[model samples]
Structures are given as C-alpha cells and as structure tokens.
Target: MKYDMTLTEKQNLTAYLISIATITIGGSVYNFAISYFLLNETGSALYFSINLAISSITFLIITPFSGVLTDFLNRRNIIIYGEFILMLSILLLFIVTYFYGLSLFSIYIVTFIRSLFNAIVNNAFSASVSNMFHIDNLQKVLGLSSSIQSSATFLGPILGGLLFGISSFELVLFIFLLLSLISFLFDYSINFELFKKENISNNFITDSKINYFKKFLDEIKSGFKYLVSVPILSTVIFVGVFINFFNAGDMVLPEKMMINVLDFSPIQVGIVNGIMACGTVVAGIYLANTKKIENHLNVMRWGFIICAFITILIPIPIYLEKHFQFNFLYLSTILFVKFFVLALINVPFIRIIHEETEDYMKGRVFSGLGVISSAIIPIAFILYGFIYDLGFYFLPNIISAVIIILLSIIYFNPKKFI
Candidate 1:
C-alpha cells in the first residue's frame, strides 16, 4: 500500500481510511436493519420511505451551509466533533432501544440528527482531501478511499442481515456503537492540518467588523460567485446534475424488471446486486493501481456514453425470459459493466474539481455541487417510479440513454466544457 509516502503520511492515510471504513460499515448495517425493523413494526412501507427521505431531505437542506462551514471552520475540529456527536447519538439510541425498545418518532429524530452531522462531516472531509496528501498521490488515495467505501457498502448489508437474523436489535445497535467509537478514535489520530497550504483566506473573518452571521452570508455568496466564475468546473457540475437524474434508471429498473417482469427469486436479485457492487469495487481498484488520468472530461464523457449504451441492453434479457439462466447471466453481465463504467466517471470528475477549483473555494463548490446533484436523485427516483408503474418498464432506460447520448454530443464542445 506504500507508495512514495513517509511514515507519518502513511499513518495519517491509514487512520483516515479506517475511520471512514468503520463509519460506513456501521451505517450500512444500521440502515439495513432499521428499514426492515420499521416495516415489521409498523407493517407499512411508508415509514421506511420516510426514514430514507429524512436522510436525503436533511442532506439537501444542510449540505450547502455545511460547505460554507467547512471552509470557515477548523476542518479537523469539525470532523472530530461530528464523529463525537455521532458516537453520542448512537449511544443514546442504544440506551433507548435497550430500556424502552424503539419508537418511530425517536428513530426519525435520530436519523435527522445523524443526517445533519453527516452532511457537515462529509463536506469537511471532502474539502480536506486536497490538503490531506501529496499531489502525486491524490488520485491513488481517492481511488483507494472509493474502494474502501464501496467494499464497506457491499459488506454492510450482508453482515446486517446475518446479525439482525439471529441477534437482538439492541445488540445490533451496541455493535454499531462500538464501531462508531473505533471510528472516532481513528479520526482523532489524523492530522488534518498537516498538509494545508499557507496564506489561504479565512472566509469566516473580515476587517469590516461585521457580525458572524453577516460574515457567513457573505462567504456563501463569495463561494457561489467563485463557482460560477470557473467555466469548466461549473459546467461539469451542471452536466453531473443532468446525467445523475437519468442515471436513476440504472437504480430503479434492473431490480424492478428482474422481479416484476421476469419473476426472479430473492437469491437471484441478491446475486445481481452483489455483481453491481463488485463492478464498482473492481473499477476503484483499477483506478488505484494507475498513477493519474489525463483528460478527465474525456474519460467521464466516454464512461457515460458506454454506460448509456449498456443501459439500452439491460432489457434484452426480458425477450429471452424462457431461458432463466441466460436471462440472469445477460442481466448480470450488463449491470456489472454499467456499474464499472459509472465508477470510472466519479474519480475523474472529483479530480477535475480538485484540480480546477481554488483551494479555499473547495468547500463551498463541493457543497454546492453536492446539493445540486443530490436534489435531483429523489426527483429522478419519483419520475422513474412513475414511468415504471405506467407499464413503461423498457422505456426508462431507452429514453434515458437517448437523452444522455444527445447531451454528450451537444456538450462535446471542448472549448466550453474542458
């Protein structure tokens, strides 16, 4: 795992990776158990959807401001305090679950609080990345981090199902609490300021003697101003919002078709999901082994194109439904390639943002991008869900692919986008 890093650098990297991994794994397990737990308790999918919405809606509301806070505040403190709060929250949940069992209201409240802090911590961590490691190793670190996260996400649900099957809900919470503590300790050991550059302006302060709230507002305005000023950066972000909306088809249609259209079993659906996640992990590992990417926009555009082409092929197996094994294999193969290409799009897009934006502006820009990108996902999901319900099972992918291909061509002007 050692590249050209020094001992201290390596230690910091390890601590950061471990911290993120533990947090993700714990969260994944908690999420899986909580969803089914809520449904079983209430016998309603509405509660589960509400729980999911709480997280997403909280992120939408908090993320933009979190970005400003990330740039203004001591990032290290933000992360540490955020993790500490998460640990305390989980501890509280553990106690509540053990004494009184779980209530829907209590669960909702905890989810909101967790989402709020997660938004802040995620923004701070993302904005801190460029300052966390050497430029030469930036892509490598990002790739490795992506793989770590993808792996945690892949494993968390499987582990959650296993644990939740045999153990008490309180035990699951207790285990998550322990992992949270481990993550907090690892985060504490990281030196977030070690690689920070000098003379970067602190947007939270001003010689105009303004109040803190006024300064914060001014900083946010400046951040947006800077974001629009960079043609390439903002353009790519806009493209991301556009692409991500259409990308929801990939999320919605596959499982829906496998079950509703072809009548796949639980085991078959689970295997398909495992294949999708494995694609992401494999792509991340591939990127990590490479040194750098040239022409990030080009790579991302091609990735999108390839994914769109694959998306059109996803419904082909429906015609061959008589052959169960063939249908499964075809769907699995295409979905794997789709996710692999999707993963390819992410690292370069991030690298582009890192390279193009000013160091001081990263938090706001990233946060702004986050807000823009995330807001569209739920909307996309709703639209795709509606289309699917309308008996347009195959239209979603085909239409989405056509739109992507057209957008790619329309925005293919190098001078404007690159």
Candidate 2:
C-alpha cells in the first residue's frame, strides 16, 4: 500500500488527529482525577467501580443506536455535538462541585450523561479514521494515531495526579472543560463526504427515515449482518469482547493492589501510567515508520501471551515488597510493557477493521464491536470490586492469567476460527 496522500487529505487528517488527541487528554485526566478522588475519600474500590460500571453499561447500550446515528446523521456534526454536550456536562458538574460536594448519586448521574456523549464521539471519531486515510497508509496512520492517543492516555493520569495533588480536583475539571472546547474547534476543521456511494439528491429525506424506531432497528440489524459476513472479522470482534470482559480483573485489581498493597500514592500511580504511555509512544512511532505486519493475528496472539505472563506476575511485586523488601515499581514495569505490546496488538486490529469494512458499514462495524466489547464491563467491574472488598486482590490476576493463556493457546489457532 502506498503511503502518499493529497495535501487536503493530509490537512484533514492532521486536524482530526489533533482534535481527538485533545479530547482524549481531557477525558483521561477526568477519569484519573475522579478515580483518585473517590478512592481517597471513600477508600472503597466498590463505590468507584460501581460508578464506573454504571457508566460502562450505559455506554454499551447506547452504542448500537449511536452507530445508527453516525450512519444516518452528518458524522462531523455528530462529533461536534457530542463534544459540546460533554463539555457542557462537565461544566455543570464543576458548578455542582463548587456549590455542593458531589455525592455518589451525583457522580453516577454525571457518569450516565457523559457515557452517552462519549459513545457518540468515540464511535464517530473511530469510524471517521477509516474514511480519512488511504489503505496502504492506514496501519501506519493508525499506529501514529495510537501514539498520539498514548500521550493522552498515559500522561492524563499524571497531569490529573499533579493537579489533584497540588490543587483541587475542580481545577482539573476546569482544565478538562477547556480541553474539550479546544478539541471541538479542532474537530470542526475537517469536512466529510459520507455520501460517496449513496444518492445525493433527496438524500436528506431518505436518511431521516432512520429516526423511526422500525428503521432504526433495521439499520442496527444490517450492521450486525455485515460484521457476521466476514469470518475473521467476526472472530476478531468476539475475541475483543472476551478480552474486554476478562480483562476487567486486570483493570481494577492492579489499581487496588497499588493503592493498598504496594502503598503507592495517586501521583505514583499516575507516573507509572505515564511511563507506560511513553513505551506506547515509542512503539507507535516505530509502527508508523515500519510496514504493516503481514500476520497481525499472530502479533495480537503473542500480545495475549505476554499480558498473560504479566497478569500472573502482577501480584509478585507486592509479595516482594512485603517479604523481601524490594522497592522497585513493579506495577509500573509490567504496565509499561503491557501498553507497548498493546500499541502493537491493537493498532493492527484497528487497521484490519478499517481494511475489511466499507464506509457505510463502518458505523455498524465499529459500534457493534463497541457494544459487544462493552457488554459485560459493568458485571466485570462490579464483580471485581466485590473480589477486592473480600481481599481477593491477587486471585483475580491468577484467574485472568489462566483465562488469557487458555484463550491464546486454544482460541488463537486460526484453523479453529478462520
């Protein structure tokens, strides 16, 4: 695949990239700030995970309709509106924080609204990526995109930690608001042509039919059939779903260990996550320059194996600290490698989705994948929270390792699925 692009395509892509990076940074900081605040104040992973679960479950449900929205509406407008709503919501939350301290219920309410907007913006932006770049350069562009995003993902927590450590959480929220507004401006720069294959005349009326419940359901069904039509793509989506579900243990358990077992402060946790992002940045730049890996499945398969090993070993640092008096940042070390491998493994998967699906179908494919991937995060989050409350912190890691290893050995054999 040739990597060359027209000047206009280049500009649009650049604008889109900057826009997404800004918003992602804001979102990441918000997540870290809140997690640290809740964990510190309540000292309960259960409450924090419950809030997270509610948001995730709502996000899962909204995603299907969101896909229909992305396909039916102007994709750019959908992105723009989504950001504005999120920024507004954060502003309101900031106001609430200043006037009255946030209760658990207030947090859940805000999380619910944020999830709706996030489902729209995230799904639309990802779908747009498929449309914006050339196929030859798609993987490399995706890698570069991941690298840009890694800065937001990894550094957000550190920024959040520092902001929270030195100042108030509201300050972080204010910064998030500013970022969102700027992100929307960047997003507005690109133009879209989603009607490449469809009729242009009277298109507005035809697309409006999607507003009806029946038409909406029909559209959602079409997206599903499209995904199932491709065996490898279908398998990939299923694998992603299972990975997300089982990996919930890793998400919660590690933070729990870091907080209680490793005795790391939020700033330290942020630093570890930031370091992990740095690794991803390096991996991403390499992928951006290198040609695509011919066998992306194998790359992802090995990723599972590497993460499985790390999952099993996650609890060891705490053991060492308690028994052997080792003082290394164990969680940070494992996460660094984990995110680096993730950049390799995930960027390719995204490229495949873009390569496999058509533009009109991009909405359903991305949204469907999102729905399934998020289907059980609530359950996983809440269940893991209970596991932590019961002092089975390391047990979840053991379970996750076994699940991942078994999946890698059995499920990853292409002969079975492909």
Candidate 3:
C-alpha cells in the first residue's frame, strides 16, 4: 500500500528516515572511534575489553527504565532532545581531549552516560518508526532501514579506521558533533504529538496512589502481561533469544573453524567476511523492493528450516577437508549462503514486531526486546568458550543446529503460528 500522507507529510517522513539512517551511521562510527581511542590511550587490549564490559553493564542497568520512560513521554521529543544531548556529549569529549588531554577514566565516564541515554533514543525511535509508518508496507521500510544499518556495520568501521589514522582526535569528535546536530534538526522537523494518544483518562495520577516502587513494578509487569496475551510476539521474542544465544559462539567459532580446521589464511577469512556482508546487502535490497509477503510467519518457519539445514552443512567442511580435497572456497560459499538465510529470518521477524505491536505499548515492547536480545550474549560466550575448550570442538555447533531445528519444529509450526 502507498503511504497515507500528503506531499508535506511524505517529505517529513522521508526526512525522519534520513535522520534515522544518518544517526545510525554516525553512532556506529562514533562507537568505533571510542574503541580506537581507548585502545590507543590505554595501550592494552584488556582495557578495551573492560571498556566494552562496562558499556554493556550500563546498557543493562538503564534499558528497563528507559523503556518505561519512552512509553510515558513524547517519542519525537525524546529523539530530538536525545540527539542534542549526544551532540553536547561529543562536544564535551572534544574539549576534554583537546585541552586537558584525554584519560581512560574520562572516556569511560562519557561513554557510560551516553550509553544510558542512547538506549532511550533507540527504543523511542524504533517505536516512532512504527507509529509513523502504519501501513502494510512497514516491512519494506524496515528492510530499507536494515540495509542502511547493515551498511554501517561495514562502512562505519572503514570510515572510522581512516579517520582515526588521518585526523586529529578533535577533528573526529567534531565530525560526530556535526552529524548529531544534523540528526537533531531533522528529528525536530517532525511533530510527534500526531502519533501520541492525548485523551487518556489515566493522566499519570488518579490511579497511582499506591507505593511508587510498587506502581513502577506493576507498570513493568503490564508489558509482560501484554506479551503473554500475544502468542506470536512471545514466540518471536523467544525465537530471537534462543537463536541469538546459540549464535553467540558464532563470533569465535567461524574464525576458529576457518583458520584451524580448514587451514585458511587471514586474507581468505577477510574475503569470507566480505562475502557475508555482500549477502546481507543483497538480501535487504531484495526484501525492500519485493512484493509484500502475505504469509510472513510461514516464510519465517521455512527460513528457520533452511538455516538449520545450512548449519548442519557448515561443520561438514571441517570433516571433508581432511579427506576429500574440495575447493578451499567451499567454506566461504557455505558462510555466504548461511548469512543469506539469516537475512531471510529477519524479514518476518521485523514484520511481526511492526505489525503485531500496539502503538501505545511499543515503547515498552521495543525496550523489552532490547533487554532480551542483548541479555544473553555474555553468558553464551562464556558457556561456548567453556565447551569449545573441552576438546569436543564441533559440539557447540551441533547443539546449535539441533536447537534451531527443534525450535522450528516444536515451537514455530506453521499451523500454530499462522
């Protein structure tokens, strides 16, 4: 369906999308710069990892409260004000580094503060996108947004690398400040009041005469209650949690498998990563332009089945390379194909969140999603690292495949979900 908007409204929508893409790209690069700065300043790889852990902990602490606030407040204003705050933070970084000389502790403080508020902006902005684009074509828009974001996963690092090498710290910080201000201006043009419910009887009072902490707990509980009421949403989040949990070892396993088992060189590993990225872009573009999917959940089930089959094949290369001398590129081919299937999984998953979630509750839902999706990575990494050291190298991968296949079969049946 076409967008239901006047010319000016369409223009405003386009600007907001551009703002989202711009902010995402800028944020990605900025994150890379922070890591780069820390590594250079501390001269210790362990310090960089420590910084990441601190940032992750901060995210975990602030995300739940931010989700609640997004639901309570104005989304557009949150986005606008949030960007300005980010811009000021960048400016602070620039001044601190240029004048007093940057320290590891100072960088940590800045990153922690920004990470807390960035969680709010992320949740509010995501919910706002659904509110702004309520038509059936939300999938297409989300596809394009994903493509733009995935571009950052590749482009942001390259840009950050070049800037880190070529420019002064102040110059790089200035660029982020400029980008954040630009995003703030674009978001400011959008009036979020149009998307909010104004006539509600529960205007933050009459009902909340109980204890403050108890009321807060109840408000948070309402999100879970709503999720329990919707089987599809609960199932989707469950699917994300398990799949992402199993996939955590992926960060270490692929590199280990490529270098140790297949005996591939560093250059070959880089080429394989490039291919995976190319697959993401191609899949995102295909979904963005393709006709609407009438059976999103059914396709998602098939996507899971296909990925499960691919996962079974991935470990085959290790066994085969020792016996039959297949082409070394075989691993790359399988990895590329796997990511393509991963892209397939995203289409229905994003569509379900956009379509199934209620506008009023979207802030909480997206925030809750952020918490659930991220809450597993560290545990999975530790668990996988433990098992990978037990000499049963492929055991984790086997368990991963089995879990995906069983989840697809047991929980995500076509008849049940559809």
- Per-candidate Cα RMSD to the true structure, in Å, reads 2.2, 4.0, 2.9
Pairs that clash in candidate 2 = none
Q: Give the best candidate by TM-score.
A: 1
TM-score for each model: 0.95, 0.82, 0.90
> Per the 3 Å backbone cut-off, how many clashing residue pairs does candidate 2 have?
0
- Return the candidate ranking by TM-score, descending: 1, 3, 2
Candidate 1 C-alpha lDDT tens digits along 44-128: 9999989988999999989888988887778989999998998898889889888998889889989999999999998999888
Alpha carbon lDDT at 95, candidate 2: 93
Ten contiguous residues with the weakest lDDT in model 2 = 194-203
After best superposition, candidate 2 residue 245: deviation in angstroms? 3.1
lDDT of 3 by residue, 42-136 (tens): 68898788778887988887777777777777677788787778788888888988999877877788888788788888888877775665456
Query: Clash pairs of candidate 1?
Result: none
lDDT of 2 by residue, 192-276 (tens): 6522345223242366545577776888999999899987788777876687677777677767776777777776776666776
- Overall local distance difference test of candidate 3: 0.73
